[model samples]
Target: MFEVERHCGPTPRRLRETDLPDLVTLSTAAGWNQIEQDWLRLIRLVPEGCFGVELDGHIVATTTAICYGRDLAWIGMVLTHPAYRRRGLARALMEHALAWLDQQGVEWIGLDATEMGEPLYRSLGFEAEESIERWAAQAPGHIAGEVLPVGFEAELDEQAYGVSRRVLLEHLAAGGSYRIRNVGYALWRPGRLAYALGPCIARTPEAAERLIRACLACRPGENWFWDLLPANVAAVELARHYGFTPRRHLVRMWRPGRAMRPRPRFRNEWIYATAGFEYG
Candidate 1:
């Protein structure tokens, strides 16, 4: 068995641009799909809110907290190197990140908890909110229909996610955007292993399909990842229509702190595709 290097206990520190390589390596070792740029975005977006632990002079654990003002926030990217498993490093970083977000006075903190991490999250008081699934398929051969870009629906988005996600959505908007007037919007961005279609908010299946086709046309024949809430039958049907199959599952978990209980839940039925696991 490998052993921790002597006198090499690294405390929680702010993740920096310099830690990008180590971050990617740690996540890859865990069979995750995050890439270098993904980790860098988190670092630059909220360096102070990103925390990591080093072992043997390399980062082996990490956790990120993103705040949408004091009203809502999210904790994600909780990962640790395989060699360091069960040593409490991931737990420590989580506790640290949660404490930090708490200090920020964020009313609600949520995360998409993987099966392995659910028990720990339960101990920390994060109750199940809903089921999120990762669906995937090869890009459709032909664009199904005409889709229009009607610009961002910030007000609609606010109702969908319960908080304005314009900050995050704006950054990913460059990837691609599909929208329908008075209906919904969907975005497509490149991912480490495939293109991600998500944060999709649609009023109807037709609207969602319109947005989905626009994105698939942008990158034909490439792998696509769609994370959606199964509660919305339309979202699930749309995925199947596009040949997307359920690949992974996660529970949207939430913990309220320094605020009232029964935290306000987001409109999951409206979220056809998530921005990313790290994001939601």
Candidate 2:
């Protein structure tokens, strides 16, 4: 197990599957939108890339890294127990995550930074890329649409994200509905508090709206969450049209010195929402 000593507390170490409950506890305590399944997916996707700080035999802080086939690495789920704040646990885990990604020779590193964490990432040389907004709404009673095959949805996602994320998309599809049309697609799954919609990709604003509406229709009567890129004006308007309101803001940041060919572009106009901040 990887371990790093902190000046103010016990040594931090790599996270294991057994840490899921603790991870969920920490996330819930922080009022974050992650469930045990989400943590498990992170571990299954990048086993050695997650790290945490434990105290009294329980995890008190955490951070995770998701590597996209050595092309791009996303750092997220950075959290610290309320009582552990100001002790540098967040910074320590971040450094460890960065070092591990460096050892793997990842070409690029990125993350969606919360307001409180932006300064730390900036000081570590991460530059701002785009702004992400959290949007929420109540699900409608019903949606009239058809579910598409995973293969089709993956293709649309690849074009909008600028990278193939078949594994991630497949995992999501298995868990929730994959609504698709000739011009767009959307994937949504259950969350602790609401049904989450994301990674929505389309060829036009109208298609994007249709996809989101279809996703909402899949799980009516429940609250829904959508993380959007503000640059997509149509997406923002669509969210509003559907009674979705902005809830939070996150800044997408990236470290330099890595080249991502056809670099992951959101095709903002085509992307109505993201899978989730942690994965993207």
Candidate 3:
């Protein structure tokens, strides 16, 4: 038995590295892949917005909202304890989190939900942006001439804050809001600039164009690839405009059951230059 509650506060002070095992248990129970690094990053970046419902002090249902550049807030990792479902804990946590994000002036919110979660998200006002896509390319020759006209600079070092911030903004343009973690990259090439997105203040389409221009300018003679949310209007349109085509699709899923009722509106917009394939 458990009590469903709404918690809106900073991350619990009692959290320790050892708590990861228990956290993983609940996350797995909810049908999510284990991602330890992501958990740590979320806690550090938005402790107050990360909420959980516990049964007799045992963490059960949980959700996190991570802030991106200017107008985006990414919500993810909505989990519920197996024994604690049918109690509405997931809905409590998610609604509270989204409400908090809305209060913070976040206009664009994003999340990849599991199939089971789709109904809840749709009810909560989260529409499906697109199915996710992925592709791979090798060597400079792979992306020789497919560049966009954004400025290109390599990370000075692994801990370079300047590079990390710029990359974050670029990512916001290409994909959607993304939480920053230690997803390390090659310091040498740092990948070529096939696109140029501006500071966070520009229109999404313009940011995307600059990103593509940057990619073209930097690579000049190679075949670069990008994976975007399947429903991203800008991405699908841009792909057609640039002669790119669909290669694959992925469906998201979650466990427990539906409690949320997010509305389905708004298409996801994607920029280039800083897409996922370039993460490596």
Candidate 4:
């Protein structure tokens, strides 16, 4: 295995496809669910947004920022090799991301922070917003019935996400996606360890359940990951009813720093599931 000194200065740079193997190693080491496609998609989505820090010419730490217009943005994929922890890598990478976002005129930023990472984010001016839960299960299922497709407007999605990111949906729905009669929609995709179902939004619990049931039936007995906000009781109930148990927890944080203006209106009660920690 490659080795490094006890301490190394983090040298920030843009990431490339050639770094795929290293990226996978970092996420796998942390027991994260990202695969090559997930990482590559981000690299392609925002060519200059994926940042990595190298030590002695070897990539050791990384962070990514995606601005969904000037109104809002998200920072994710903050990873550092275990051998290089506590050496100012994460902080440096975070600073780099924030500076870039500021240049893009992004007024609001957010992330799903693990308990281990929460304190660092808080130090950077991110405030707790809500609890994000990852629910999982493996079970066979059959569609309750078919619901005809309907027009899902960008404004409709912004109502739940608080930002318009219609372009992102095309990439996130690569595996398979389904939409119900204007009131609800759900998407499912392949992950490193399992299929992920999420970003589900609906006007009513019944609409949400129908969309969820449709996704569950798509892959019978396969492992699945479902991320949702606990503040939405209907979302919590749907996961439990569909046999998914809580697998992970994260604190959703918004950078309410002095740099930020008043926040947008976010309605999580209508958000049945979040897209992914990386994409959110």
Candidate 5:
């Protein structure tokens, strides 16, 4: 397994399947939404990229990197058990992910950083790109409709995400519903505590609202979550109009001069909501 030297205690190592239980404990303690399956998906997608630090034979810190076909890589799940803080475990795990990604020839590395984590990432050469907010609301009544096939949705996602994430999209859409129109689309899936809406793309604010409204109407009266870029004023307004409140904030940061291409030809205006901070 991957291992790193530490001055104080046991070194961090590659995360294994057996670590799931302790990993869940770490996430739960941090108030994160990741379930076991979420961890499984990341491991299955990039086995060598998941790492954890242990103390007293119990996992205490974790981090993950998921590369999207050498185009870009997303770093997430950075968590440190409260009792294990101030030991630099989080930074060590992050450095491991970065070194691993670089070895794999990854060009762009991106992540959603919390206020508490921003300084570390900035020190590692990541610059803030945009602000993201978590919006929550009560689900609306059911609205009947069939989600379009994955092939159809991927085209729209490609335009908005600026990269091909067919694998990730397929996983997200497996049990989700999508509201699709010629101009936009919105997708939502069940979460541990609420329904999550995201990857919403559209040609205009009105189109985005239509798709979001339809998705919310599908599961009326239940709690819902939506993560959107604050730069999209219309999207923020749409959420506010729907009684959704911003509950959390994160800054999207990326390493400079690392994009494989100058930048993907995508329309930020069409991105009303991102798939999720972890996956993006």
Candidate 6:
């Protein structure tokens, strides 16, 4: 039987290898789903950021902090073993991780909250921004691949990389990180360009909604968005019970720094949990 132990900062155990099975157990126990791929992507892109809590040499809770630079960081993957709840382990691990980022001069820290975690984050100074809403339209019941929606582009083209680069550059230009996770892609023919990430219909609101519907159709359940600011009243209003809510709110508590411009208007229509908060 395992018993609790205190964390030793910056230890080798902090960056141990993790797998989906371990993450699945912890996440399901914690009532968090839909982020397994995000975690998997992070392990590939940046593994050193993943953290775990061990009791009697068994892993229990886990968290990760993705540091973008001296001023930007995102902390996520906060999970605790079901049997270990209410033991202060989650709080302790979070504080340690946030402190480490602070030490690194990460003035801006962000995270998305689960219902159970909202109070904890609120207690720790994470303010309510705006509630997030998810609006999804089921693909045409009888639609065939030959009839892919208009303006529905795939990321599997010669220009795909350049397009992706532009979107990420725009993201960073807006004070957001140039994260490769939120940029959705599709795996088409092995060598052929499969799918595209940024297929925006920036002119009409309905067109924007259709673009999102189109993207969701292309990947089915393979692609998603995370850490988008809740700034769109129309999107929020359209998202009730459609897989969007305050639960989707990308919460943050930073030490204060430079101001960012208002978020992109297009984000109001399409954004799902892609690679967890660490990537955003």
Candidate 3 lDDT over residue span 31-138, tens digit each: 433445435544655667677765676776777776543345566767777787767777777878777776776655666666666778878766554466543332
Overall lDDT per candidate, in order of appearance: 0.82, 0.80, 0.47, 0.82, 0.78, 0.46
Q: Which stretches of candidate 3 lie over 4 Å from their true place?
A: 3-18, 133-280
For model 2, give the 10-residue run with minimal summed lDDT.
1-10
Order of candidate numbers by TM-score, starting with the best: 1, 4, 2, 5, 6, 3
lDDT value, candidate 6, whole model: 0.46
Question: Model 4: residues >4 Å from true position, as ranges?
Answer: 1-8, 141-153, 257-260
Backbone clashes in each candidate structure, one number apiece? 1, 2, 46, 0, 3, 9
Cα deviation in Å at residue 92, candidate 1? 0.5
Error of 4 at 111 (Å): 0.6
How far out, in Å, is residue 179 in model 5? 5.1
Give the C-alpha miss distance for residue 3 in model 2, angstroms. 17
Over 4 Å off, model 1: 1-10, 144-147
Clashing pairs in 1: 199-273
Residue 40, model 3: lDDT of 53
What is model 4's C-alpha RMSD?
2.4
Candidate 5 lDDT, 1-280, residue by residue in tens: 3233455544668888889899888888988766777777777767888889877778889988888767688999888888877678888889888988988888888899999789999999999988888989885445443444332267777777677877777776654545454566676776666788887888889777767776777687889888988888888898898888999999989984354465454476788888778887
| TM-score of candidate 6 against the unseen true structure | 0.61
TM-score of 5: 0.87
Give the alpha carbon lDDT tens digit for every residue of 82-147 in model 4: 887777788889988999888888888999999878888989988998899999998565545455
